[model samples]
Target chain A: MPGSFVPAVVSRRRYQILGIIALAALVGAELLGLSASPPDRDMGHLQKIMYVHVPAAWSAFLAFFVVFIGSVLYLWKREERYDLLAAAAAEVALVLTALTLALGSIWGRPTWGVWWTWDPRLTTTAILLVMTVGYLALRSFVDEPDRRARWSAAVGILASLNVLVVYKSVQWWRTLHQVQSSPSTVDPAYALGLRLNALAFLLVLVYFILLRYRAARLERLVEAQAEARELAQGEELHV
Target chain B: MTPGSRRRLVLAGGAIVVLCGFGFLLYGGIGENLVYFLTPSELLARGERAYDTPVRLGGQVLPGSVRWDAEALDLRFRLTDGTQTLVVRSTGAPPQMFREGIGVVVEGRYREGGVFESTNLMVKHSNEYRPPAPGERPQDLYRTLLGEERS
Candidate 1:
């Protein structure tokens, strides 16, 4: 068994507690959603989808950040641990991206009167999703662990850079999408509830990534242990 | 390919996908996330009451209906597909070219009363509306063109 097993146990327990807390927080947010007023004379019920859609996109951004950090660490230190963390975060990011797209489409169908648009936000999100899935595919097909780690790290880093560009492209290009909602752009009327919902969603996202990372770590440990046993049996047969 | 060379290809491919994908999306939604547009003619032919959903109606600014209540800072105009006319109300200054017969997009909710309470107004301009080649298209091309077409 790997000596790294000790830290894995503590992390697993921590993640489980976080997972429970996140679940409770999400349920609480849903209750808040119930009491929330429908859209004003302008926006309508489609505004409510912001509570769900914004958070999913934010979480996807957070996950990509994780992937970026992990990728950088792996490249710098040549450590496999960083690579595993990057992979785990990428998986979570992929899920969040999918959720964001789905929720956004649902919202768009009503507000924009179309199920999909080539809006800056939606388009950037689609690209992010495709790149993430492609990264995972590359990892699975490559058998050499070290080579996989390096290649995936490079891809992750490039994709992370793309995220920033995609974000800025709206402002740089004369696109139809509105400029990003900054702190200044956030109307005081909607800010408080939106902040609270955003906080709740961020907590849930953090909890989910941590939990998934723990599971991934456990799987890695099990595989290493099995490989060690196989090596021992081969040595014995040789003797 | 050498393993190192293969890694380079992966990076290049990733960059291409990101760049091209974003370009396509931006190109598609430019001016507005105008995925689909219904002209005034289409709206009338399909029946106004057919879909209760809110969508963008693209058409020429009807010549006479524009009236600005300057004291109240309320701008009201009529948009027509040349078939059915709909009244539009906005509280901001209309675009410079937003005079009669120019293309504009008004985003708002559709009311049962045949009114679209516009919250946002976008002036849709053609690419030719850019800085004129020295003496190519005059500053007031629309006026000149209308005059020529009439005479």
Candidate 2:
């Protein structure tokens, strides 16, 4: 049975190449963002923080979207692979959400004169971070694979619905946090740096998710092998 | 249709209904619970109901209406939306950027005397960047710390 499974060596090599590419992109992105981008007319040097803050936010949202797709597929097809993908995406989304919040706060202190506020956009984002953390925790407390997959999939789907609310919160309510900044709203001079960082973050996200999914599959295979050995021992004792 | 396919269709339909119901409830709850920021005119338009409930009053600080007592930590100002003005009373050292004509959002409740008692005062500025005025650089504000480190 173990031999029937796909060899790990090939996948490990693929992950290594991906990891190196991701690291290179991240380093290049930082150099370009820190040096190449001119200072903003309003925010000055502080605007440089946008390179990290915005990309982290975009990646976090992208991760949640993956979770949404994974959850839906898991429910429809009852596939363990879908559950693994959803779990992987949720963990990544949680980390990126935390980074987004931290960077935004750091940016806020100098600009908004406060470290944090209860503005709609900021508040909803914090809620999203907490909810995703809860979803990951739910996955941990359940030991049975099928039960865990079913429960967490439902939660992943529901929690991702909050992403829409977080995105729309600024428009739905009057918030101190500024509305989403896009290329149209941002100065043309800043666009290149932002796009570069966004691409770098995206590459890093893809690498992390693939690595996590592969790890999950390996763990599942090990568990199956252990269960099979236990069953064989029981049969020998009965004989 | 096969029984399995029919069952799946029913399950999907049920999930959609449940999700829609949850969405509606969430929307209604947020609408009622959210204390939206309003200008003085909009708050007044709500009449007596606006009194004592938590509200975020946002507008420019009326020039010449600011009164601050540093020792007492009492700050008073009038916020205006051009058409109407409301007095705000707060207790704190105003933020370093607080100034007349700048936008501010005060979180608190309006009292019977027409004063908005703000528990928090947040200074807001336009997004357009401008070079710091002479002597107002962030580095200058931390000169004492930098001097200590240098020594």
Candidate 3:
């Protein structure tokens, strides 16, 4: 067990700093996102949904990355903190994924003339959302900390792998949804703004995950302390 | 693998197969409903063969091309994308945003000589907010005429 990595508990001041950073990033993302004039000659005001929908998708993917890393750490070190972080990230991912789907649907209704379609990226995103929800449900059923961490870590790794496959599969298959626009394909003028928007969103996502992870750690510490207090009281009664 | 892990693996396998298989089917289904967008010029470029096929045409609304008959409840307008033009005829009222130079999507079948018989007409607008250029204020001429008809 030598050199096994242990979770470093986050201090309160560091947690508060993370919260402030996340708030600042969120404001920057919103400002940059709205500055761009939506694409001309189609979709109209509804095109603005792209700002929220794209960022939500980005954050969901980021959270899943955390889940993957946490799973690996838990497997290698057998530390329960990794599992708790994975659970918190999964919860946030589920919420963001759901929002992504809802916003995509709203945008689709005007452009595609349909509220929902069986597009490859859409289907994959929906599946990923469902899997994250199922992982959260599984976490709720397990009682033993070690056993829950072990089982969920396995689930987290598997789900993260599947998300990668889904992303790749969409590219391989020709479908209703258009392929992702990249710098090479995009006009230089448009790509510059998009790249900035993406970077800003990423910063926000990183800050949110750090804040949530610290909160989860603090919650676990409080629960442990409460249990210790109950045990001491029972021993005192016996004495 | 533990019994629970074995079960989870099976569940995972089922999920993958269902999701991938469904995705495959989705591609096939949307293939038929996948309407390719075309500008008026593109549609005209294709010639008479483009007729009788479902097509979506996007273009700017040409000013002075809009004509309406209130008693008959029929309306006609020309959609142009600078290089080409197509006439759109509809019995129902167009979307509120439908105005001169505003972009639109017309869906239905085209006929010989490049006339699109539209079953549906949708107005499209630029997402940018540079503001309508000076002298480009939208006029509700259609609504005004319709009001004059009822009066």
| DockQ, all models | 0.05, 0.17, 0.08
Q: What's the lDDT for residue B127 in model 2?
A: 45
Please, what are the lDDT tens digits per residue for candidate 1 over residues A1-239? 37754343664566678878887887787667646533322233435566787778787888899999999999999877788889888998889889988996776554444566554555666777887877888777565678878878987886776678567865664333445666565444445556667778788878777777677677777778888999999999999
Model 2 agreement with the true structure over A1-239: per-residue lDDT tens digits:
55443335456888889989988998998898889766554455777888899899999999999999999999999978899999989988998999999998888887667889877788778767767866776676556788778878987998788899989887788788767776567766677888999999999999888888878778888988898999999999999
In every candidate, what fraction of the native interface contacts is reproduced?
A: 0.01, 0.18, 0.00
Q: Which stretches of candidate 1 lie over 4 Å from their true place?
A: A4-6, A11-13, B1-151
The candidate scoring highest on DockQ is 2
Candidate 1 residue lDDT tens string, B1-151 = 9997687667656655764565565456443554444665666566656345666666667887777765565877788877778777777655334556666667666676767677766554331212233445322533332333323
List, residue by residue over A99-191, the lDDT tens digit for candidate 3.
Answer: 878987777666555566544567667767766766776676565567778877877887776567556644664334455656554444345
TM-score of 1: 0.64
Query: How high is the lDDT of residue B51 in model 3?
Result: 81
TM-score leader: 2
Clash number for candidate 1: 1
lDDT of 2 at B121: 87
Q: Indicate whether candidate 2 or candidate 3 has the larger lDDT.
A: 2
lDDT of 3 by residue, B81-133 (tens): 88777888777656544566766677788877446788877654343333233
Docking class of 2: incorrect
Query: What lDDT does each candidate get?
Result: 0.67, 0.79, 0.66
DockQ order, best first, reads 2, 3, 1
Give TM-scores of chain A for all candidates: 0.90, 0.94, 0.84
